[model samples]
Target: MMRLRFLRPPGARPEKEFLARCLQCGQCAQVCIFDCIKMRTGFNPFTSGTPEISPRDAPCHLCMRCSAICPSDALEDVSIEESKMGYAKLDRKLCHTWKGFIICRSCYERCPLKATAMVLEKGIYPAITDRCVGCGVCEHVCPEQAIVTIPTRFVT
Candidate 1:
């Protein structure tokens, strides 16, 4: 099977486990404060109603409320610091700041984990760090489309 890449809500298990464990109850979507979580669409029986976050539409705030109310533990109640929904990768060649065409700070300014997940190199150009949780805010805010948030969905 061709592995599909998509960001799950924080606390989601590996792909196989998440599909098996998720009840598709929509509880996680109900409790999301940032309204980032949305039920998966399409007719795939293996993935219907599973909560996902598309940072371009809305970015997760790292609030663990969705996990806390999960009756089936499909979304584990994990610490915000440990959340790894996805990671942001910068294409510096396409970046306005890096290219010196513009001093755009869109990604840096919008990063939820600013200074930790996204930082300025040499106090100017933005760089992604280890602390990045791949929340996709940078991807949403990048004016030059220089950022692509890489989802961390693990497949078996």
Candidate 2:
């Protein structure tokens, strides 16, 4: 499986404070310019109104649409820098590189952060760098599902 790196906001206080206040009414989701805001299934058993988005499915663009539309401050106001999801990891075992396939570069080629995040290594099959942003675009774009982004907290 591809390694994922989760980047919680600095000083994140269960930052669920914002999350807990949400009504999950879909207003914020509707206002998302990038469609990154989504409600999680069974995110809360007692309270079903909380909305959560998977940064892996669609990383927040920091457009602030969701935060602005949130009536209850369920989505806190954060700067793009404060809200980054962080680096992504590519599993050599599941990647086409390890499989000896030549069908995909979607991960390497599609990375929005470029050289800083997905640098290339020299080899017959090649490899990705350590600076990945865990955007999951590589995982989603991969036809093999060889890539997965895990929370950075789990690493090290």
Candidate 3:
């Protein structure tokens, strides 16, 4: 079975440190302008009520509000480039542009970091760059569902 993957709010520390510092106060959820942050809902005491972002439902806009309002410093105040929420991986096999079926720039046009995070290789195929902070905008805008955001916590 595939493990359920979800992103933490921007500027989230490493999983262990984030859990230790998190107050589970829901302040991050309350302050999210995009309503991207949701308190984890489950009976598991270890993870219940922790802030999580489901990028497909709603992607982080990188406004930095949630991190700024986190009183426990569980979510650090960091710039958009430093957020490190996750990184986007594009599947060339499923991508419309890469497959040569159509020129789809949806992911590239919607990416907050545009040109920097998701670039148009050969001015056509969308390519993820090393600068990607994994804000999930690319995954959210992908019409072909060719993009996936691998959460930073899981990557480490």
Best by TM-score: 3
Candidate models: Cα lDDT each: 0.84, 0.54, 0.90
Q: Write the per-residue lDDT of candidate 1 for residues 1-156, one digit (tens) a residue.
A: 322556888877777888889999999999898888988887888887888888777878778899899999977888876778878899999999999978999889878789988889999989999899888888888888888878877733
lDDT of 3 by residue, 24-114 (tens): 9999999898999999987778888899998898999999999999999999998899999989999999999999989989999999998
In model 3, state the lDDT of residue 63.
93
Better of 1 and 2 by TM-score: 1
TM per candidate: 0.91, 0.61, 0.96
What is the TM-score ranking, best to worst?
A: 3, 1, 2
Better candidate number, 1 or 3, judged by TM-score:
3
Candidate 1 structure, TM-score to reference: 0.91
Query: Of the candidates shown, which would achieve the greatest lDDT relative to the real structure?
Result: 3
The runs of at least 3 residues in candidate 1 whose Cα sits more than 4 Å from the true structure, single-residue gaps closed, are: 1-5
Clashing pairs in 3: none
* Poorest 10 consecutive residues by lDDT, candidate 3: 1-10
Alpha-carbon RMSD of each model: 2.7, 5.6, 1.9
Residue-pair clashes per candidate, as listed? Answer: 2, 12, 0
